[model samples]
Structures are given as structure tokens and as C-alpha cells.
Target: MLTIGVLQMTSGVDPEANLAVIEDAAKRCAKRGALMLFTPEMSLLLDRDRARARAWIESDAPDRVIESLSVIAAKQHLDIVVGSIPVAAGGGKWANRTHYFHPDLGPPVTYDKTHMFDVDLASGESWRESNAYEPGREVVTVEDTPLGRLGLTICYDLRFPALFGALGDRRCDAIAVPAAFTRPTGAAHWHVMLRARAIEAQAFVIAAAQVGRHEDGRETYGHSLVVDPWGEVLLDMGGDAPGLGFCDIDLGRIREVRAQVPALANRREIAKS
Candidate 1:
């Protein structure tokens, strides 16, 4: 069994402050025998203003945040997956990018978010992510752990079933869904959707999330979770304070579940009308 840790945090605008908390959580997780650690989207900073975000966000790959995270991962000898960072993608657009790092790897493999949350919520929480960011084109999967293949995705991507299907088709043993889901939607659909994905894909789901109110006064749902292929929630951080949750997993269960259900082979192309 492999131990995975999910870090739930409430981050503000200061990268330094955020890193301090994250590093502390990493140490705690490492102490608990976690070989892999995952953090939420906007792990470094959470700001409502796009222009202000561009000021601290970087265009190059090796920014202060990424560099610091790389050093942390190397020092801890932990496989780290940090949720979306606002990457300067030119023309005043930032890419919501995810980073996967290994202890001995030179640099992390970046995964830009393909799905943007462009809807207006019932609570009047409106997000025009496309207004400030560019969408990614490819799905990224890497294998560095005993857990086999791992796929990466960001917040809004959770709503789309096809993305998970693509990941499952690639024989991904687990999917990392790092999110900063707003309060209303998260209260309603978060648990259901996450569990559905876990059951359908027959893969372990690790979702580290941003919770509580931000400096921008935006309230987030803070139930960071880890679910198994059988749709069992292993750990759930209930509030805004930074915390880590562990889940012991046997990857062989993935094969056993998939074979018993045989869902992946059940897909069929539909005839066009």
C-alpha cells in the first residue's frame, strides 16, 4: 500500500506566506509516511483581479513558486503535485497551470487547465477565466510512483466526464483534481460529482482544495478529499485551516475493479443522425 497526502489550504495573495504553510504541511505529511503530496489550485496566491495577478505571476517556467516547490520536493524526496498557478501566457493572459515534480527530476512537467470556469453562479459569483487565461490543448500523464500512471487536471475540468474517460483509457491508476470550488456549487455538487468520477473511472481520486474566504472576499468550499475506486472517501478536511489527509491505497485494486466491471471496454461509437 502507498500513502498519499492531500493538503487543504486557504491561501491569500502572499506567495511567501502561502509557501510557509504549504511547506509545513508537506513536512507533516512526509512525517506521516506520505510519498506523494498534492495541493489545491491557486496554491500560491488567490486574487480576483486579473491585472494584479499578472504582476506576481511569471511567464517563464522556473518562477519563484516553482523553484521553491522543486527544492521542497527534492528535500523531502516526495512526489509533489501542485494545483494551478497563474502562468503569464502573454497578451495579458495567464495560464492556470498544474505542476508535477519528482525528487530527482530537473524541473516539473506543467499541465495547463483545459476547461475554464466561465459561468455566473447563483450567489452572484461570476468568473470569466477565459478573459484572463489561455486553455491547454493536451492531457498530461506521468508515472513516477508505485501507483502506476497518474493523470492531472484542474478545477472546472471536474464537470466534464469525457476528460475522466480519456484519462481512464490511458490506464491511469489515479487522477489528481486540484480545485478552488466556490461555496454554493461545492456544497451541492462537489461530493456527488467527485464520487461519481471515482466509481466510473475505477481509479483513486485525490482532490486537494481551497477553502474559506479569500482576501478578495470570495468564499470557497474547503472539503479536500481522497476517494478510492470503490467510491469510498478516505479522508476529508472539513474547514479552511491548512491540513493534510492520508489514504493508504493498493493499486492492484484498480485492476480488480476494472476487470470485475469491464466498463472501459463498454464504450461504443454512436451513429450520426
Candidate 2:
């Protein structure tokens, strides 16, 4: 069994303040005996003000948040997945990137979010993520972690089954889907989709989410969750507030579920008509 920590946050516009929260969470997670900690998307900064955010977005220099997290990971002897942060992707566009920091690993492994959240909700919230961010093309997975093989994904990437299918094909034991979901869509789809993904992939799904009202005039659905390969919810930190939660993941459950269903083995390629 692997004990993991999930940090649900109401991140604001200040990177310094957000970093402070993460630092404290790392210490708490270490004290709680968690081998790894997962945080929400935009854990560093969640500002709609592009002009103000650009100063912190990494271009020519390394991101300060990532650097700090690396040091913290080593100091705490904990692995941390900083859900997603903005980094310059060249061509004047930034990428929503996930960074995995291991205590022994010299540099973190990274994954850029593949799907963009560009939609007009019934609640009058419209996001044009592609306007400022570039989408990633590669599916990323990490090996030899406390949880065994783990897949990396961010918020909008949850909606794309093909991405999860790829992770399933890779036989990842657990998948990290850190998110900053809007209240309306999250209320309607969050739990159901996470459960479905766990069922389909036959892998544990760990989603640390952003919650509550933010300093940037936005509200997110909290409910940070951990679902087992059997589609059972191991933990759910409800929508009320930002906090840290822990779940014990049984690696043996993956084998047991796969033995019953064998869905991944049954998969076949479809030919275009």
C-alpha cells in the first residue's frame, strides 16, 4: 500500500503566497507519512490577468515555483506532483505543465496538458485557453514511484478518453489527474467521469482539485478524489474548502481488478472505414 497526500487549493494571483501554502503542505504530508503529494492545477498562480501573470511564467529562466518544490521534495524526502503551472512554450504561447519531483531524482519529470478548456458554459463562463496556451502532444508516464508506474495528466485532459486509453495501454498502475475545474461543469461531470475513467482504464485515478472562491474571481469544485481500479472511491475531500487529504492505495487491487475484467487485454485496434 502507498500512502499519498492530495492538496486541494484555492490558489490566488500571488505565486509567493501559493508557494508558501505548498511548502507547508509538503511538511504536513511528510509528517503524515505520505510517500508522495499531489496538488491541484494552477497551484502556483491562478490569475486571469495575463499581463500580471507573464512576469512569473518561465521563458528564459527556470520557474521559481518548480525550483522551490524541488528543494522542498528533497528536504521532506517526499515526492510531489505540482499539478500544473504556466511555462512559456516558445512562439509566444505557454504550456500548462505538470512537474513530478522525487527526492532522489535530480530533476523533475514533466508533462504538458494535452487538451484545452475552450468552451462556453450555460453559466456564462467562457474560456479560450488556446488563446494563450499551447496544447501538448505527448502522453507522459513515470516509473519506479511509490505507486509503481504512474501516468500524468491535467484538468481538461480528463475529458479525452484517447489519452486515458493510451495510459491504459501503457499499463499504468495509477494516473494523476490534477485539475482546476469550474464549478458548473465540475458539479455536473467531475465525480462521474473520474469514476468512469478508473473503470475503463482499470487503474487507480488520483485527482487533486482546486476548490472554493479564488483571488481571481473564479470558483472551482473541490472534491479532490482517489479512485481505485475497481472504481471505488478511496477518498473524497468535499467541495467546502481547501485542505490536505490522504488515501492509502493498495497496489494489489490493480491485479485483482484486471484478473476479473481483463479489459486492457481485450482491447483491439479499430480500422478506419
Candidate 2 residues 75-154, lDDT tens each? 99999999988999999999999999999748899999998999999999989999999999999999999998999999
> How many steric overlaps are in each model, in order?
0, 0
Pairs with backbone N, CA or C atoms under 3 Å apart (clashes), candidate 1: none
Q: Tens-digit lDDT track for model 1 on 152-196? A: 899889999989988988878899999999989999989888999
| Runs of candidate 1 exceeding 4 Å displacement | 58-62
TM-score of each: 0.95, 0.98
lDDT of 1 at 36: 88
lDDT of candidate 1 at residue 107, scale 0 to 100: 79
For model 1 the local lDDT of residue 102 reads 88
lDDT of each: 0.85, 0.92
